[model samples]
Target chain A: EDKVVQSPLSLVVHEGDTVTLNCSYEVTNFRSLLWYKQEKKAPTFLFMLTSSGIEKKSGRLSSILDKKELFSILNITATQTGDSAVYLCAHLNDYKLSFGAGTTVTVRA
Target chain B: DAGITQSPRYKITETGRQVTLMCHQTWSHSYMFWYRQDLGHGLRLIYYSAAADITDKGEVPDGYVVSRSKTENFPLTLESATRSQTSVYFCASSERYGGRDGYTFGSGTRLTVV
Candidate 1:
């Protein structure tokens, strides 16, 4: 069975703090890893990491995949109140996606 | 523009009843998927369609049936609703299958079973 696990199920941080969320996976025919940010509604895409050691960045958020270690990490620097949400990580196989439990982040002022 | 939309954002059904959740996307993507999100579980795939007339089962599809008669529409029907099936259902579409690109998801539908 394909499985994905995320660390730090929940976190509380103040604004301007830096946080790192971890995701590890075990699946057959590994393809890519994706990150999403979910608020109250649907989840929105954040980053997609395919190659190892190569990082994908968007503003204060960035992610990198370590295929050899079978894991990935999402880094948020100088976090803001808007960054308080659930960060989801998914491992992609052929056409299926296995997601982790997600890390719920709460950013305080 | 509505990239993806799910109907009946919230619904309540009884066990043994049949319920169908609708998903529609205007992107004409080649891949569409149905997933259920629970409190503990982030997201679990129930079904996915590669294209029109081609549908496949995902991790959880025993009680669910899906049809893709049109590329833009993929609907999931629960033959018999159960308490365990109560969760938030999300529809997603991607330009291609098994690629690095991310998926576009709908707002989601919350279902409750009694």
Candidate 2:
């Protein structure tokens, strides 16, 4: 069984603050790590990290994967109210993708 | 719409009854997946299909069934619904194998069993 662990299940921060989310995984056939943001409906793709040390960024959101550490981190800079959502991290191993419990981020204006 | 779509945005069923959730994709992706979301569990895969007729089970497949008779459609069925099955169900599709390119998800269906 593949195991995924996310830190700080939930957090609250005011606008303009930066938030960092963490995810760790244990899998037999690692392929890539993915980040998703869910507001009230479907989850939207944020980033996919396949290599270590390199970071993927979009607007104020950025993420990086560490294959050696078996973990990944997602950072949100200058957060806004619109950034309040559940951040999910998933590990793609072979044909299956497993997700962690997710981090609920609440950005207050 | 050129994206994944899930039917019955919300559904309410009784225990012991059968319910089927429908999923469709307009991108003609080769891979489709079904997942359920519960509090504190994030999302757990129930089933997936590689093609029209190649379906496989995932981490939590018990009490659920899935079939992909067409390339664009993947439906999940609960032979005997239970309260424990009440959750938000999401359907997703990917264009390539292993979904290394990331998957596109539908709006999801909120199902409740009484």
Candidate 3:
């Protein structure tokens, strides 16, 4: 069975603070790791990491993957109230996705 | 619109009753998937289709049925609703399965079983 685990299930941070989310996975035929942000509705795509040590960034969010360690991390710098949402991690293998329980972040303004 | 859509944004059904959730994508992606999100489980795949008439089971598929007679539509049917089956259902599509680009998801349907 493929397993995906995320740490710090929930957190509360003030505006301008930096938060880091962690994800670790164990699976065969590994393809990629994906991150998503979910508010009250659907989850929107954040980033997809396929290579080791290569970071992908967009605006205030950044993510990197470490294939050898089988882990990935997402960083949100200068978080705002709008960044309060559940961060999800998924492992893509053999055309299927296995997701973690997710980390819920609450940004207080 | 131009993105994936799930109908019946919210639904309430009684136990033992049958209900079907509708999903449609205008992008014409080859892969479509059905998933359910719960408090602790996050998201779990129920079924998926590679194309029309190519449906397959996923992580949690029991008590659920799906058919894809058309490339743009995939519907999930619950033969008999159960309290445990109540959750937020989401429909997603991808032009290439497990490709560099990830799947695009719909707004989701909130189903409640009583």
lDDT of 1 by residue, A1-109 (tens): 9889999999999999999999999987788999999998899999988899999899999999999999999999999999999999998888788899999999999
State which candidate, 2 or 3, has the greater DockQ. Answer: 2
Which residues of candidate 1, in runs, are more than 4 Å off?
none
Candidate 2 CAPRI classification by DockQ: high
What is candidate 2's lDDT per residue for B6-114, written digit by digit as tens?
9999999999999999999998999999999999999999999999999999989999999999999999999999999999999999998878668889999999999
What are the per-residue Cα lDDT tens digits for candidate 2 across A39-74? 989888899899999999899899999999999999
The collision pairs in model 1 are none
Q: Is candidate 2 or candidate 3 better by lDDT?
A: 3
Q: Residue B42 lDDT in model 2?
A: 90
Residue-level error in angstroms, candidate 1, position B80:
1.3
In what order do the candidates fall by lDDT, top score first? 3, 1, 2
The TM-scores, one per candidate, come to 0.97, 0.98, 0.98
User: In terms of TM-score, how similar is model 2 to the real structure?
Assistant: 0.98
- Cα lDDT tens digits, model 1, B1-114, are 758999989999999999999999998999999999998899999999999999999998999999999999999999999999999999999998674568888999999999
